[model samples]
Every structure is written in structure tokens, then in C-alpha cells.
Target: MYSKNVPSGFPRGFLWGGATAANQVEGAWNIAGKGISTAEVVKRSTNRKDFTMNQITKQSLTAAINDSSTTTYPKRRGVDFYHHYKEDIKLFAEMGFKAYRLSIAWTRIFPNGDEAEPNEQGLLFYDHAFETCCKYGIEPVVTISHYEMPLGLTLKNNGWAARETINEYTKFTKVLFERYRGIVKYWLTFNEINAAVWGFNGTGALDDDLPNDQKMQLRYQALHHQFIASALAVLQCHKLDPEAKIGCMLARMQTYAKTPAPLDVRAAQLQDQLNLFFTDVQVRGEYPNYMNRYFYDNGIELKFAADDEEILAKGKVDYLSFSYYMSTVTADDNNITKATGNFALGEANPYLTSSEWGWQIDPVGLRIALNELWDRYQIPLFIVENGLGAVDELTPDRKIHDDYRIDYLRKHIIQMKEAIQDGVELIGYTTWGPIDLISASTSEMAKRYGFIYVDQDDEGRGSLTRIRKDSFYWFKKVIASNGREV
Candidate 1:
């Protein structure tokens, strides 16, 4: 348990940073030898409407591919970060960022995932990007594949479901490792690798039209391929630059039993086990014993090469990083009310409040998640993404008063300090998005999560101006004081 009277601050040299994905932030999707990615095919909703997983069905995706209109696909014009990266990095520096978490759009490096040669233009863009980060003394934490893969891979190879895609991913990772070897030291093999299992839409590797059993089989197979690719990437990174710290990213979803009944407790435990399956493979380098019965019951048989287990055993991650937006509850009874979070659904906790998007707010859950992860993995943990996404209004005086956002962050930071005091080896905390960008689930700008506000809207109409909200200064002071002032 965590106590507030410990009278301590964050560890020395703790990384204070922000995170963003290329597909959500960097526009210029078709330029500089960049091929169309799966993200490019996701249509942006016109109204501020929430999207269900059915929105990206196979038929709709095919239509989006043939549409040839970038207007419908807002990810094609993601905040224009490709052209405005220097400006944006400058803003991050102004906020006194010690690190920046971003992704390398795989399509940008390899116009097609299985290409023989790399794109010089795309490589040079990241070269300049990393150099700029180094210029400001901000360490770059790069995710090799952050829900952005070349569309060609899915169409031709069925994404990671096909074993060949692993080779292609290895090629991509090698290019990144060799190119940014010395400049970037922190690497995340896959963003939310577990999303491939439950939230297949985010992985962009699943076709919604597939049969239920087939979908499950393909999803698990694809997850297996990613595990192998991640492991191989870890080995390659060490060989190229032994100092590089490569970690696996999981969408950590903490759950609680609705009642003290043994059935409810067992249900919640099973749900948590399913959620932790990805981390178990990546961090432990082997499948858990429980998975044997799971595979038998589901009739899911994963294909493996002769050396797959050996490869996995040798390529375990150096650390564990994850995103925690909310916690949930479960029960054997169906009467419990449900709530939504970052592509996850569970019973609502009556005691906790929710955000505009109906995501339950639980600052103490963050501390609980930290302790749980540390106790399980016994490795250094990184809070790579945690924030509150709400509607922000720019006042008449051109200032945004986001005291609510500040309060949300302050409470979470307090819990984070307590988690550290409780003996969790925490590396750092980077808020989901330091500047507003496209929402991953809804593709709307209105669902903003940033201390620095980007002037944009659902229809993609704004001056593309960047403004610092009240929380921005508050965060700056917190970082300056090393989490003492928060």
C-alpha cells in the first residue's frame, strides 16, 4: 500500500516527457516516398460521434482504399506534424521535456513492408527529427511499429498472420536499428502489442468480415508472429547497440471483482490473465502454463519454427512499459452497468467519476496498476501513457483554462509518487499526448488530451496554432521541481 506521508519526491533524473504516434500526429501521409498505411484507410467520422469496431469492416476498408479522397481519411492529414515537427519539438522543449515518445511510420521507411531497399527520404526525415531532439537535449523514445503498418502487408500477406510478415518486420527493425543506432537508445518494439488480441482494430491487422473462429485463430497467430518479431528485434538491437533499452508496450487493463463471490473473483482473475498474456510472452519469453488449456479449449494451434522457443528465451525485454487510462470491474451477474475506455469495456465503478468520453477516473487505480506490474514482472516499469481526454475551449482572451486537466494530472502524480515510495522501480511518466492530435479510436480532434492545445476540430478546420494551456505551466513547474510541486 502507498502512503502520502513518506515525504519524498521522484527519483533523481526521472524522465519527464510526452508521447505521440506518427499516424496520429504526422501528416504528409503520401509524400516523401511514404506508402499508404492501414491508418490511411480509417475514415474520420464527420460528427463528434464515437465509433464502434464495425466501422472498419472489410467492405468499408476496401471502399476507403478505392475512394482516392484524403478528405474522408483524417489520418492522412494528422496535425501536419510531418511538416511541423521542428515547430512541435520546439514546443515540447519549451515545456522542459526530458524525453519524447514517438513512432516511426513503417510505411515511410519501407514504402512496402517487404521491400528490398529502404527509402532514403524517409530515413533522412527521422534522422533530422532525432537530431533536432538531440539539439534540445531531449532523449527520443521511439516505437518501431505503432499501429501503423504498410497497407500492402495486410492485403498481400494478411499482416502478421503470415509468417513472412515477421521477416519483413525484422527487415524494418534492422533498418531502424542500423540507422538510429547511436542517436536513439530507447526503443519499443511494438505499441500496445496486446491490442492485436482484444482490440484488433487498433492493430489494423484484422478484417472484420472474417468468421468468428477464423478471426480468433488469425488474431492469435498474428500475435505469435509479433512476439517472435519483437524478440528478434530485441536481439538485433543488443547486437547493434548494446546500450539500447528495448521494451514491450502493453495496454494494461486492471480489473476488480464486483462482489466477494468466488465466481466473480475467478472471473476477474481470468480476465486479468487474458490481458497479461502478451506481457507474459514478451517479458518472460515463454507462454504461461494456463495458456495450454486456453489453446486446447479454443482449438487454437500456433505455428512455430524450430528455434522459436530458443529465440524467445534469448530476447526478453529489458523493461516493461504500458498505457493505463482506467480500471474496471467484472462479475458473473450481467446486471452490472458497463463503461468504456481506450477500446476496453467493463462494469462501472460506482465510487469513481468518469470523463466526457465515459472513461472511469481512478487515480488510485494507477497506483494499484503500478504495484501489480512491479510485483509480477520485477522489472523497471515506465508509465508511457496516462492522461485525461476532455473537451477544451479556447477562451475569448486566447487562453485556455484547463484547471480540470491540471487537477486530474495532479492527483495521478500524487499516486505515482506513492507507488514509487511503495518500492516500485519506476523509470518515468509521459502523458498520452502533450499536444492535442487525432483521437486513435474516434479520429476526432475534439477529444483532446494535452497540456499544450493544438487548434483543431472534428472537421479538421483550425489555424494549426499551438497554445499552452494552464496545465502546461503547472506541468512545467512539476517537472522543474522533479515532481515535488505537483
Candidate 2:
């Protein structure tokens, strides 16, 4: 049966825009009073097996230094948004951007990671950047800590493990709340809280590998700390400016059962349980019953003090925001079933096509994901990341004919509008990337997902110029007509 159609247009004052992270887009890795982040220390490929927990010994850093002559900065000079904020903001303004979502680099503010005083230069950079967005009348949505934190903090204090991270994160939040009080009102406490459970495992939190048991324990512990930290940040926001809206962000990928069998149903249910376990604590201030049981069964006891629950309860989020790129399909299995090709992990939907990197393209799955989240949480959701990643060819006229991207967005926006019509209180929709920038999962530049094409490549060689793709014009019309134009 066909679902009901949306009305001709979106709600009044709907937000239509794009999202970027500081580490992915901000290229001044060490400039403007910034210290070395974990990203800077990364020399080998992240997709490799060792990427999860390979520690940066002195030997690795020294080897990096010795190889500096031969090694070009992998993340350095990433589209140069630090130096081109005016031009980029101008591009976003051209799209009638209702909001431009970006993150503040924590290291930029706390250079050594423990300094009580924030560097004036780091804070000033965002001050100017926010002013630029304001100049273009684009609302700025700021993420407190994206995937990249100061490497020094992780090496010494152990990222998100020690209680000290909560304090450090709180200080960072306090600085932003005090400084950008009225200029920016929308704040996400952490980039992808669910990722902590996954173990910087994919595109966020701590990107280290460990034994299966330790991985689960560390992930849960990190999440516990972040939940408390987010709650505290929310409380702090209310204290500083009661009108500010604070939300917890998660990397929410929808999962489906591969078939109608009971095991598939159970697999899909477990997937949902895994994703919502993070939100349940943040929104409801208590872990779900099944999740508690699972931890007990796995002997994964999370470390928490008496007051942590109180903090979470007091600081329940105002809204829920998430990034949706693709959906995965799963079937239950106790062992790796290499022969059947269906026993474990995601088997991308055969019915759907995939991106260059093999992420399935299912726009309707986006609607399914949205409705599922809304049904469970009941909080207003912001679709913070949904777009196509493709390989682009810069034409002779410096234009990218990216109709595939437009079609991808067009279908997703259609699903979003349908969800909104079906009583989903969606706050906004910002595609994965507004302009081309670095990829978070693969740390590659070729994974382009932008309405604005950035002139750069994986090797980091280009003019750093910006050109509007066809989707840029398409999105402008969609925003102008309140999505009815699509």
C-alpha cells in the first residue's frame, strides 16, 4: 500500500541547509592556536585493521617527523575552509541556507587539552566564522566536540574513559555558551554519542580497536561519561541562557531484517536496541531493560557514580539530532557465516544501489528510519546528515553535473516531507555535506557529498575553489518554495 502523500509544501520556517564538522572541513589543523589532534597523528589508512587501537608511540610520531619530507599532510589543507569562510558562507547564502551546521574544534580552544584558559585565537576564529554566517543570515548550529579531540588528551587521560574528560568537555561547552550565547542557539553536546558504544569504531568518539570484551566495556563506559557530560552541558546551557536549545547527536543508521524470518526480526530488533540504548539514557535518563540485561549477560558493567543518573535526569535533551547516510540489513548468527553470506553483519539491500564506497542508497529507508526514531523518542528530530557521496569530474567550465546527487536529495526530502505530514515533528534537514570536505570514516577526500563542489582531491591538490553543483540550484528552489518546488 502506498503511504499518504505530504502536503504541497513544508511547514512555515522549515530549515533547509547543509552540515559540516570542524575536523573534516576546517583545514588549519595546527594554525590559529590549534594543537595536534588524533587526526594529525594518523599516517596510515583508517580503513585498515590497525586503525581502531593503534597507539601513537614516540616512535610513530618521530617516524612521522622523519618522514615529513616525503609525507604530505593527509588532512592538512582540506579545502581550506579556515581561510575561505567568507567565500563559503557566501555560497551557503546563495542556497538560501536557513541553517549552516558546523562544529568547534575542541583542541582549537584547549590547545594542550587541559588548559583552563581558552586560546583567544581559537575562540576568535569561531567568533568571526559565526559572524560570517550571521552576515549571511544563516543560523549557525555548533557541535561542541566532533570526532577529533586533542591527541594529547587521549594519550594522557584516555579519551572519554577518565572522569577528567567530562570536566574538560564541560569547560569547552561553558566557553561556547558564554561567548556565542545569542549568536548560536542550537548546540549538540557530542557529535555521535552512539559511536562511543561502537568505539570511535566508525566515524566518531574513540577510533581504537580492542579485544571484543574490552571494546564493549570501553564503549559503554565512554558513553556513560558522555551522557553525564551532555546532561551537565544541557544544565549549564539552561543556567547560562535558558532559551538555548541543547540536543544530543547520534550517528543513527537504520537497520532492517533481511527477511521475514523470526531470526531476522530478532536481529533487526537487536540493532534498534543497540542504537536506542544511547538515546534512552539521554532522553529518559535510564537505560532500557533489555539493554541492562544484555550488559549483565556480557559482563559489561558500566562505571558510574551515584550522581551520574541524577545529572542525566536533570539534563534531558530538548531535541534529538542525528545523521543518516545509509541503512543496513542484518540476520542473527552466532558465528561468522562466510559461506551463506547472510549470517552476520549487514548485507546491503540487493534491491538498492550503492554509493561509490558501497553505502546503500535507499531514500525511502530514510523515511523508515525517521518514523522509527520519532515513534520511539517522541522528541523533535533534525535530519543532520543525508546526501549522496559520488566521484565528480570538474568540467571545462568548472561545473559539476551532479544530477545523481540531486535525485538522491530529492527523494530523501520527499521522504522527510512525508514524515512531517505524518506527524513527525522534524526541526530541520541539513544534507550530510553542504560542500565537499574530508570523509570521516575513510579519511578520504574523493568521497564527495556536497551541493557545492570543492576543488580538491584525496591527494590534497587543487585550487581550493568552490563551484555550485546542479543540486545547489535545486536545493535553493526547494528551500525557496518550502520544498514544494521539488
| lDDT for each residue of candidate 1 in 1-486, tens digit (9 for 90 to 100) | 875655377988798999999999998988999998988888776544354533466677779878877567878888988888999899889889999999999999998787899999999999999999999999999999988799888888878778889899999999898988888988999998877865345455665777777777888988888999999999999999898899999988989999899999988998899989889999999999998888898888988899999999999999999998889999987787888887567899998999988888899999999999999999999999999899999999889899989889899999999999888989988999998988887777888899888887777788999898999899989988999998
Name the regions of candidate 2 deviating beyond 4 angstroms: 1-8, 44-73, 200-210, 334-345
The C-alpha RMSD of each candidate to the native structure, in angstroms, is 2.3, 3.7
Model 1: weakest 10-residue lDDT segment is: 46-55
Identify the runs in model 1 with alpha carbons over 4 angstroms from their true place. 1-7, 46-55, 199-203
The estimated TM-scores of all candidates read: 0.96, 0.91
Write one digit per residue (lDDT tens) for candidate 2, span 198-254. 454222234344667876787678778888888999999999988889898877767
Best by TM-score: 1
Whole-model lDDT, model 2: 0.77
Compute the lDDT of residue 265 as modeled in candidate 2: 96
Clashing pairs in 2: 52-208, 52-209, 53-209, 200-206
